[model samples]
Target: MTSILLDTPNVPALKVENLVVDFKTKNGVVNAVRGVSFSVDRGEVLAVVGESGSGKTITSLTTMALLPSTARTAGVVEVDGHDVLNASEADMDSKRGNVVSMVFQEPMTALNPSMKVGKQVAEAILNHRGLSKAEAMARAVELLDRVGIPDPAVKARNFPHQLSGGQRQRVVIAIALACDPTLIIADEPTTALDVTVQAEILELLRNLVKETNTALLLITHNMGVVADLSDRVVVMNAGKVIETGTTVQVLTEPAEPYTQALLAAVPTLPEAQWDAIFAEERTGEPRHAEPAGNSPLVDPVLDMREVCVDYTSGGRKLRAVNQAGLVINRGEIVGLVGESGSGKSTLGRAPLGLVPVTGGEITLFGGNVLKASTREIRKLRSRIGIIFQDPGGSLDPRMTVGDSIAEPLVMHGVNGKRPGRAERDARVRELLEAVRLPAANANRYPHELSGGQRQRIGLARALALAPELLIADEPTSALDVSVQDEVLTLLLDLQKEHGFGCLFISHDLAVVHSVSQRVTVMQHGNVIESGLSSKVLQRPEAPYTRHLLASVPSPNPIVQRQRREARTALLLSSGTRGS
Candidate 1:
């Protein structure tokens, strides 16, 4: 039941012809999708690839006939032979979950938080089918199991919040498949997951297409996921399809310059390239920069020995972080890499005392973090800064960006005297300029800025104190590929400018490789491997690290497809043996 060569479907699972969508905004008429035409056949995966504001999402919405009143759309959209372009509201609603379905990017948003997961899946079945409550519930449990949920019956009763991110996504898939849809639109399905969870979800989608002959219209910006999953690709840019071809044709030999640039933005595992990074001359000398430089013998800005974090959950002692040791010398960046629940974040928080450490010795700026009093820790924190993954969340929406950046200076200062309005204002202006934002942007609120801008504002605020150490946790993971590259480049430049030691925590191996001088791999609360990024990325020693690397989807279409096949074969063999 694998996908066949490209061919016109007798009754195309999903089709869009000359689609045009526009919205009347406060500013002017904004064109979202313009003359976008494509078709997805049964059992085939057609990926609509583009970055933010590229009309990839608008085209999908047009097919579902889900635009708001402000939207003006002209198109021929067909779903399983239904004329979706002109279908009535009632007709569209009736056909939505039955004939066509959608798997949203964030499962938490898609699902009802108050309801049990089983009932959510059952609701879809009850929507289209004339099944009794008991029957629908039974069908829901079956679907959960079919989608690879362990203890499906038990899990069905749990609320969405009780499930892990990966599990919640699986429930979403089960809901989408409940009615046996002819077409499924998956919008950035794996963007929120780790590489390992992403691999599982992709495999599930591929198997679903094979088992049920369902067409998948995957809308995403991830080129690696596109190369690994798609049979054909439609490259969209500025509300138009720039190029449309087979995956190999588009990826290996793209005819459009925009497509080439999109591919170029993708980060690669830094193998021998670390040499070039180390060779570059950096001017910013850290206050603690010893004659030994980043040498192992140099006094580290932050050091942890046998670090462990414990939590009380359900009346049981859960050790979130095992005995982990790490050191970050001045002017050097140390990467903490792992999947979700791997304790990398926990380990990163230890030096800052953000989490209660049951055991371990943490030293920051040569001061004992464990033995430090609240006042002492506060004094030590004057030299430390942290940037969270969601910068927008970290910022107060009510506060202006300028105020946010200035707040740190008011809280921590040299000689135990807080900066006055004059000093704070000057530092705020300088910090904003350092992050490449307009000085006037300081007056703007967090909501007024875009995602990338907010992230830059976050960096500006983190560096406002002129700290000697910084902890960046998944800082650029939520951004577009090109924007991610921009942020990383800016961060490295600034790190060099301040000569600050950084502990960069991320699930993205490619990102970790590009930034960190040294890399540590964590798994299940333990440090599994540690070495130079050059050595670890190129030739990983730990089996888990190798699996993590293998899970990363390559941008090469031919190579990724080959790996997918080998992986599928291994999955099948392992399943058979377990059975």
Candidate 2:
């Protein structure tokens, strides 16, 4: 690409004009992006926010010329006055990493697993700048250090699998910064990371942009990330931009209906606003009423006391859950909140005896779970349900939706006996309808449905046996904001109707606060704090709990900026960085 120097100094670092992208599929033509226009100036962060299939990623990929050959595009994509759309093959190749770079969503998938992270970053530098191997490697270490990776020299020799998620992402950012590109496109950079790690990554990106005066194009579904970093915002839906304005204007005072819906769907920690919105959506109806007759003799659906779970890896014992105790009464929703690897999932599995308990006791309906007989365990399985984090992976790919939902019923012999084919089929249809999916979807495969639809299918299958207790482990983490809202609402509605207790495990504090009556905070396999959601989240006692709450980014830019500043100050005072 031949660079065109603009006469005026006011030219944006990156610009797109009337961009349109279409994909020709066997079914029909799909319009991915339609006449979308945006610009990012030097030292500016521009965010494109949208739900899944809203064309945010498509627009970014087209801008970087990274889309597959099947994608047809008509747009003016320019970086530093170099027209990216019309650039020659060689020019595009040269400009890809030299003038522009992209940090993908999943660093594990983006980084070369076979190679050491340092070597991969060094390769980028060598390919673009023609530097010596030794020099490039040294620069790689420096870049890693710049991105806040501890012991950069030692970490450079480690393969991608050896590093944590946040470290791997830092390596990806290092590679992107290796060439000193004027424009950087970070696509969902922190979506898969824990909140504390997310804060650090966002801080690093913001600092890098400020230090280098580089333009940043951030594509994400996370409104919090947009509020925390972006200076301007572009809201997209159904392959079109519905709103565009300053971050404050768009987040606080969205003019479009789609934008309003998207913002309203985002889960927030403050209960009053969320409850008010939920009440309004339900036509001023309360979410749940108090139980009748204040009974004194009620057994908890799930109860754990001094539970401990351990595993031996490489002859070393790893404690996953230590003295974790909690209680969930019938029809109550209790949230388990923590960062990744904080033993939340392990504790969630204790009720069903999925994880062996080394100490303490777990009781389900007043029956000992740890020492249950085979027959008793089999019986327990029918009354307990689990919703995994990834519905795409958890759902059986080879089975039809009907068979998948009916599998549990087939195994458990619902209603004390094995049901016939007709009964099974009817139960499956009933479940699909209960989850708000059409009965016709029973014949469709999981791959044919969207992420939200697949999650609903998972929920339907989990509830196929009419379980008394549900373990929802990060059920909506991978979904879009609106879809997450839908799933959470459905879960609440179902819990109310069936009066089943729920153990909601998630790292999202806001989401946990919205659906859960009580909250338990865990860190490093230990229960740090436990109390009512309103009290624990609003007036957290433990330092770790306070840190977790503070790390969450708000949708309001001004408030989020203050939170970021306060988090940085706290970290500095503690003489440590992100956990």
Candidate 3:
């Protein structure tokens, strides 16, 4: 019997044959997944890449039988050689954490906020392994440590809210690994993370696949991530599989047009191309944009000197920005690049006086922000337009998009006077046309619009006044690559037309490279590096800047592997953990 058992071939970790999923909506039956077929073997990584609503997520969720009640599923889902689709709820409940588990996109949402993180991991272990509370808790701590959570025994006692975003994600990974599941499905696990943190999570997932021989199903829109870890690639579009091949074949020599388009949409840093860009951007205009010649002496649109911003957290004074200096020339876009808590956003907000800086000078339109009175500051703010990261949150849900776009005009008035309704309406329509949104969409609510559409509304609202300076804070971070490209192109076009100097705040280097004439690197509340995009980006001076650049995964598998080899050593030696 032992010889027979040893001789038996290993069953695939997960297999889905001709899967179909449809959601019963008020409009109609929406097909989420149509005849999707794939399998993940032990110690192998399968990546599902596609844009939003491409059924990549739906197919992964079906394996664990976690779809909503309004959805209908059909197909064979086998986990550990056992049928999952036809299994009883009781059987699925028993098998879920034991045979398969999932890591969610948002770690905070995945974890129980009220419970201690360690207990959360222990609970998963206790449910499947039938271990005592103490044993499960002990194992949970061990698992956390294995996943690189420092001082796991102590951290396990802390609530989820106490940990950083990356730490919270690590905790989530620990829960998934607690039961020694044969397969782990990570759905956009690193989507909301910084490049450095994303690199760490990818490393953790890759190590687990190798050390524990676990099958990994990674579903993401990030092609860079696909090249970094996936062994085989599956490209999905409109609920169907458009392409499939090894990672190298799919990324480098994509056979399908859709796959090719998807790969092309990804932003890349071409080092050689950046070398030719203008190095002294303060004196010259952007290559694509002409000088507006607004000021007599051509004063900077926005300038910061020794700017300091502080926030009180947990009874301790925290410096969010420190002595940050930057200058945005007229018709120029200066990119502020940094990880979370690196003070990019804080510094961006300083010009608007939204976050009061504790010290330093902010010159807006050549006026000092530090010495300006509240009335003066308010007046100066009229020349500044702001775009937030979350388009939905930024827009008022109670009003139509038209009303939202005209809100700044309502508050500040048009042409230094209280504008009539007709004027506001015409301006609203003009702005709608400018953003490429139909005038009819003015009647739509924020919730009714798609993510990309809503962001366009944000643009219309920000540019309603056509301010001299614009603050675009991570405007394209939440969008798909294709949509991101569209939004960016439109933003640049508008910037050129309006001749507004822009502070483009984002963590993405490739995006900054494409858009900004100059770039600044931030870390731990300090301005680590700053220069022209040509010099700072291609030939970074600071070690941290190079690390940040290296942390970004390449879409090419071979190049990413080479980058990984060098970056792994740097990260290990420096012990850098992203905020």
State each model's CA lDDT, in order: 0.86, 0.87, 0.87
Instruction: Give model 1's TM-score versus the native structure.
Output: 0.91
Highest TM-score, which number? 2
Which 10-residue window of candidate 1 scores lowest in summed lDDT?
280-289
Clashing pairs in 3: none
Off by over 4 Å in 1: 1-9, 270-295, 414-416, 562-579
Candidate 2 clashing pairs?
1-91
- TM-scores of all predicted structures: 0.91, 0.93, 0.93
Pitting candidate 1 against candidate 2, the one with the higher lDDT is 2
Residues 379-424 of candidate 2 have per-residue lDDT tens digits of 9889988899999999889999999999998889877999999999
lDDT of 2 at 68: 85
* Model 2 TM-score, 2 decimals: 0.93
How many residue pairs in model 1 have overlapping backbones?
0
* Total clashing pairs for each candidate: 0, 1, 0
Worst 10 residues of 3 by lDDT: 288-297
Tens digit of lDDT per residue, candidate 3, span 1-579? 011222225678888899999999999999999999988888999999999999998898889998899999888999888788888999889888778899999999999999999999999988887689999999999999999998999999999999999999999999999888888999999999999889999999999999998899999999889999999999999999989999999999999999988888888975422222224222333333212321122458887889999989899998999998888888988899999999999999898888969998888898998889999988888788898999999998999999999999998886789788889889999999999999999898999998999999999999988899999999999999998988899999999999999999999988899898888899999998877776676656566876787788889898888667657655654565431
| Over 4 Å off, model 2 | 1-8, 271-298, 577-579
